[model samples]
Target chain A: MPNNRVVNKTKTVTDVMEEQTTVAPEATPAEEVIVDTAPAEMRYDTVDIDLTQSSETMLYSEVIDMGTSPDNYVGKIIKVHGQYMFFHDEMSENSYPTVVVLDATKCCATGLVFELEGDAGYPQEDQEFTVTGALDYPSSEDCPFPILKNAVITTE
Target chain B: MDKLAEYLQYPFVRYALIVGVLIALCSSLLGVPLVLKRFSFIGDGLSHVAFGAMCIATVLKLSNNMLLIMPVTIIGAVLILRTGTNTKIKGDAIIAMISVAALAFGYLIMNFSNTPNLAGDVCTTLFGSTSILTLSRADVWLCIIMSVLVLVIFVLFYHRIFAVTFDENFARATGMDTEKYNLLIAIITAVIIVLAMNLVGSLLISALIIFPAISAMRLFHNYFKVTVFSAIFAVICAFSGIIISILAGTPVGSTIVGVNVLAFAVCWSIGKLRGTAA
Candidate 1:
């Protein structure tokens, strides 16, 4: 609820193209809403682990760990800042929303996959933003990487 | 200091620092003997060979290139150290030939490769290293094991290596198998060179191997004293370099080497004042 961007509605990647026109924020379905429905134990009731507080090197290193060492991060309330990216895989017919953090060299990249809450509008590609959520692996077969579930996106 | 403490809590950062120290200790340990024997250029030559081997491994899409790289570099080191003296081509000439050839051939291979980030891949492997902080758990373990092996061998044969290093013909006349000791030094140097390729990139690895020994030699008179001082100086410079780079966002290889250069200057100044510099 703090600096959160109100989304138009629940628009999955497949339907995102058809609904290109910006529509007014509409009432979202109960099942689609994550912030309100996600268990209060992790995201809602607790203060998130703030990643933006650290330097870029520290932040990038931690993000790399989430991939190499996943169990340590799962189900934890987390907050991070990075450039937003959207990937469309034609062979798998899947679209993934991700945030990328750059290392000191600015050559190598470390990224985190994020899933927005229901009714959240998609941010523009490569836009810098802060996202907070509980780290989880969803049931979707398209993305094998751990994604931030019930996430709230705040664009700078 | 506070910022470094905060960064140190992360596992990856800790891993990087640990590997950095171990690799520095190993390289500095080998640095004294190499510099004394005039085999300092061997580190650079073998590193270029490693780059070529790595490029080949990259082209083949091997999951881990260490398997291909380690043996190739070892063979190259043995060949150079053993045959350089006996052959007409000679030590420096043969090393120079292999060095330039491997580097050019590696770049050419990389130019034709299908890697998505060709420039980035080559750049990371050529200059200040980016792989040190991004290493997997297996890399850390392997580095530790290899470093321990090098240290153990160095400690066990310290006397023999010292004899062969200071005066090879005298050592041979004294009934020591000089060639066997030379071979041991070559193998150990090759291992450190390969590990340093990850820490400082292939191009700058010689700095890691030679700078500390040279710096220590500026002040110390005895071989034992110089070797100990070099090892200590290298560890301090390298560890501080990592901490500074993490806080300052500088490249790791250059930062470590920069610290070494600064330390060398300071030692040289001290030696000049004492009238002891060689």
Candidate 2:
């Protein structure tokens, strides 16, 4: 695979923690190695852990409602599951990832695009986050998609 | 007489029908040149600009008068025209910038407001509820009058408008003030969009503008015929879409948009078949 690593100038505590664990891959099991980077004050409860077929473990958020639209949670939350229609995002390399529109309503958002705000020490495909962020409504004659203006991926 | 009596029995439904037909006619007429120019996205942009304006008004607890939306949207339209005319930065970039900025600003305004039910109203605006099914007779007359105004403008300006849209350079060389003409048309388009947004809501207004135009374009080659056919098509789709939504218990705006998309798809396929046959 090509190295498309993007450097972070403003590395958060989470980024620093992920970097530390990345070096000790051989000695520890995946769950024990992947520590939550949030300070204990900010860290919410660790509800449960589940591994998909690809063997990536996801920590569930108690507040993340998978049944609801995840657009508003762009900057505030992470790793939320929802019933977003499965469409091949023309812009992304990921073929089967769920697409969340800015409006949360399916019809209102046509083509808004987003990238996960931070790396979650896991594969991009496994790191599904429900984030709350600023939103941009469709304004131009050509732009069909509405976007969550600036999604800050806090936790997934 | 029976139709009139039926409407009298339910004033709101009658109002909705009459208002709906007038809007359908106006949208269909304006939609022809819009489709020809392939600027259908303007309708989408205009509706969103309207959304942003309403969001701000809601946040400020301003009188939810349609007039407040007008000034904001006119500024937005002017900005779009200015940025688009430069043609140095891709039009898409300007659109992207304005769209994101407008939406973000709208949200911030709404979030900070202390109004009662502000968020709920915002949601209603975004999804576009049709409580207009219960609009009073005066409101219906207002809508009808606006629609007529739009229709009359189109009729009067059809020649100059056609000249400008078909070939601006040619029109300019022929001593026509293309820039002035284009500006007037844009203003008209902006007003029409605002009216459409008021009647059907932002979510479905673009569908009303574009679907009939697309259907007519596929079926007819003459501009006049296309406009007439599209008006008829819009009325049918709008009326039927309302009926279908009422029957199916679905979101009215979404259902109408869905109907428009279906019409477009069917018409497109037929056009494809005809092309193959020829």
What local lDDT score does residue A85 receive in model 2, on the 0 to 100 scale?
A: 32
After the best TM-score superposition of candidate 1, give how far the Cα of residue B87 lies from its true spot, in angstroms: 2.1
- Per-prediction DockQ comes to 0.33, 0.01
lDDT of 1 at B144: 96
The digit string of per-residue lDDT tens for model 1 on B1-278 reads: 77777778777788888899999998998999999999999999999999999899999888999999999999989989877978888999989999999999999998877886787788778764457877888999999999999999999999999999899999999999999999999999889999988888999999998999999999998999999999999999989988877787777888889999999999999999999897
- Score every model by TM-score: 0.86, 0.60
What's the CA RMSD for each of the models?
5.5, 17.1
Give lDDT tens digits, candidate 2, residues B70-93: 777777766676678876875556
Give the lowest summed-lDDT range of ten residues in model 1 chain B: B123-132
Task: List ranges where model 1 is wrong by over 4 Å.
Answer: A1-14, A17-48, A88-93, A138-140
Candidate 2, position B112, lDDT: 81
lDDT of 2 at B164: 83
How many clashing pairs does model 1 include? 0
